[model samples]
Target: MEKKRSFPKFLSITLIILVVVGAFIGWKAYQTFIGPSVTDKEEFFYVHTNDTYDLVLARLKSQGIVKHPDLFDFAAKKMDYPNSVKAGRYKLIPGMSNRRLIGNLRGGYQEAVKFRFANVRLKESFAALLGNSFEADSTKFNDILNNEAVAEQYGFTTDNFFSMFVPNTYDIYWNTSPDKIVARFHNEYKKFWTDERKQKAQAVNLTPIEVSTLASIVKGEALHVDEMPKIAGLYLNRLRKGMLLQADPTVIFANNDFTIRRVLNRHLTIDNPYNTYRYKGLPPGPIMMPSIASIDAVLNPTDHDYIYMCAEADFSGYHAFAVTVAEHQVNARKFQKALDERNIKK
Candidate 1:
């Protein structure tokens, strides 16, 4: 009977040992795969474009993302995440698991930047804006923009290159290269010029680029959306009648001075191709990035015999349209009187 008791006692001890081992294994598995591993203060962790796995691991520890680096290292290696590190901005949940973090990193799931701009007047400023927004260098972006060969490759001159970027909010990757950014905008430009838009542009006797240029002028001239089509019609009438565009915004652009409240006689006499008062037809390029509303206004201009426009006397952000020079002069005198009354000297 004592021997039987001893056998049962030994079996019980064996069962206890097995249970302890199983519990330990289960705890370890949970710690490695399911337990919270990330504890960063910030909501995002950045992985640069050329960061190695070792570098990323070090960053994880330094950034307080992982308390136990060795466990993270082991997991990374096990998942073969070292070979597939993508550069991007990754979101960090407060209590994420090692498996999930590594999976996201390996899978290249990252947030996109909402790239946006408006009223950008110069290519340099455009490049600067891009540099501030992306990882690419500003100087490199400017270089590519000013490169005649590169512009030629894109079937554009440096003069008309800025027209390719239609201003609006775009979902773009932060790590996108400068060249790729240009290429992407070029693709968007192509997409924007649909067959219907092309046909309308042709009917208006303007190429896509020329339409953009004219649209920029129209945008410059009008602030009210309802007035855009009327202003566009006036400009088109001038173009058809072989009259100079005589756009004040072009004078401001040529002077590189945005503070000009009034375009004086001296401003009109400036010997620059962009001075529409001196040169005929649209400027070699856009004076500013045109809005979609302005572009469409040019595409679907109001049919009218109007050939001249002047800002209204009441500062209502509207224009006075005319079919004859005498009527235009009357509107101009009213605006001049208003400007004089307001002391709007250039």
Candidate 2:
């Protein structure tokens, strides 16, 4: 009887030990799957293209976002997520589970980059801006801008390739290729020229490029939007009367000297076709990337007799318009006097 009792007691103790072990294992699994895995304060993780699971895991550990890297590695392998690593910007919230993080990464969810650019002086600057916003190299982007053969695919030349990009905020994936980036610009440019705008261009007897060329000059001349339409009208009147545009901005553009504050007689002597004083009509392309407002100012120009414009002598960002050269000379003299007083000779 004593031996039998001892055997039963031993059996009961063994059963209790097994139950305790099973309960501990179950609790550990629940913690792995449902309990919080990431500590507070982690917000982002960048997994570069072609990053292996080991590399990403190392990165996660290096970032100090995961407390139990070993547990995560095991969970990832068990879920078959290690082989399907995705490249993108991922959102990491505090107190996230390993299962949730793995699933989020495996699903390939990416955050869009809010990219913007404007008021650039050259294609090189534009390229730099795009390079900083997107993933392309700045030099490669500038090269593509100047490549005529590549530009040919987009119906542009090296000279007019800059016209494709309009100033706006574009929400796009961070990894968008340079060609696709420019393609989106082309698409936006096309959509901007609506039927009404096209008809307006026809009424003005100008192609879209011609309109843009003139608009760029008007934009350069008039620093204020309110003055842009009048300046645009003055240029249009000059074009109609077979007179030279004589735009100072064109001279600066031809010389590739953006530093010219006051265009002089010497600047007017530039032999480049972009020099409107030397050329008969519009230049081969825009001197700068004109805003849509400026383009619309050209398309819907104000009806006026003004054929010339000089910067206001008051130093305000406005212009003085004149119907005759004598009146223009008077306005020019006032502005020239102001320039001399301010010692802004260029």
Q: Judging by lDDT against the true structure, name the best candidate.
A: 1
On residues 133-222, what C-alpha lDDT tens digit does candidate 2 reach at each position? 666678888988899998888777777777677777888776677778778878888998899999999999998878887888888888
Which regions of candidate 2 deviate over 4 angstroms? 1-44, 63-71, 94-96
Candidate 1 colliding pairs: none
For model 2, name the residue pairs that clash: none
After superposing candidate 1 on the true structure, give the runs of residues whose Cα lies further than 4 Å from its correct spot.
1-29, 66-71
Cα RMSDs, all models: 3.0, 3.4
Q: What lDDT is obtained when candidate 2 is compared to the true structure?
A: 0.85
Residue 106 in model 1: shift from native, Å? 2.1
Minimum summed lDDT over a 10-residue window in model 2 is located at: 1-10
lDDT of each: 0.89, 0.85
TM-score of 2: 0.86
Lowest lDDT 10-residue stretch of candidate 1: 1-10
Q: Using TM-score as the measure, which candidate wins?
A: 1
- Cα TM-score of candidate 1: 0.87
